[model samples]
Target: MAGVFMISDHHFGHKSIIDFESRPFADADEMTETMIDRWNAVVGKDDKVFHLGDFSFLNREKTTAIVSRLNGYKTLILGNHDRGRSRAWWLETGFQEVSEYPIVYGGFFFLSHEPMYMNKHMPYVNIHGHIHGQKYEGNHYFNVCVEHWDYTPVAFEEIVRRVVPSEEQ
Candidate 1:
């Protein structure tokens, strides 16, 4: 069966991101290729992939090329870096959907490119990206950036695993 997955901050074709993120790649090309490989290795063509944000730094052609090589039905939520391109442009480059703001998923998870403020009073878990390695210290927050998930997509089942155990404990 197809699965659902989430990931963020790929920074594809951005050479500086390698040094900035301490990525294992020697350069942007290596990072991009390796990430594509990793994505395809796990995601099936029919899988649903929510790429939280900051998907790439390349031009339309390059971005489309990378997206074509990957496996999954992809959706993009804009991040700060992704805002430079119009939503239509992202669609042209192969993302099935692009949202300019946060969206609620599973009725309780708030999905966005940046972390949302949540307190105990709130009834939602915010699943977000863009902070790279900074995690909010509460069960109400989850970071899906590549840095936190071995530079690959975090499965929906895995997200449930984390949330379920926390609630049970």
Candidate 2:
């Protein structure tokens, strides 16, 4: 089976995201190319990538072009920005699946486009995105946004390391 990965808030083709998020890029093209390269470096053809949301701000053709170049079997957890577009539109861009609601994965993580409320008392961790730079102040809340994760898809093992105490590993 392919490795599982997660990421969010790529904001591709959006020039304002560079300034808004303080991304270190000369331009949108640079950001896009660099992000694609980084993604391809870590993800393989058979890898499964769960993109939590705010994937791109580009039109259909442009978005399709970007998605086609990335390595992975992709799934999108639709975010606020992902709204208004039809599911068919997203699937046409090459995503294997698209979801507007939170998905519980591995029986221990709640994956969502926006951060879900989480506490230590809860049985599962909330792995999410949406807040670009702001920190989620809880051990049970893991932010998978690009800004927090060096603009690359993170491996499931890494998330496990973060959420599982060393003693339990």
Best by TM-score: 2
Q: Candidate 1's residue-wise lDDT over 1-169, tens digit each?
A: 9999999999898899788878788878888888888898889999999999999999999999999998999999999999999999999999998999998898888999999889888877889999987788877888999888878898988997887566653
Model 1 CA lDDT for position 115: 90
- Evaluated against the true structure, the overall lDDT of model 2 is 0.92
For each candidate in turn, the TM-score is 0.95, 0.96
Candidate 2: RMSD to truth: 1.0
Number of clashing pairs, model 2? 0
* Highest lDDT against the true fold, candidate: 2
What TM-score should be assigned to candidate 2? 0.96
Clashes in predicted model 1: 0
Each model's C-alpha lDDT? 0.90, 0.92
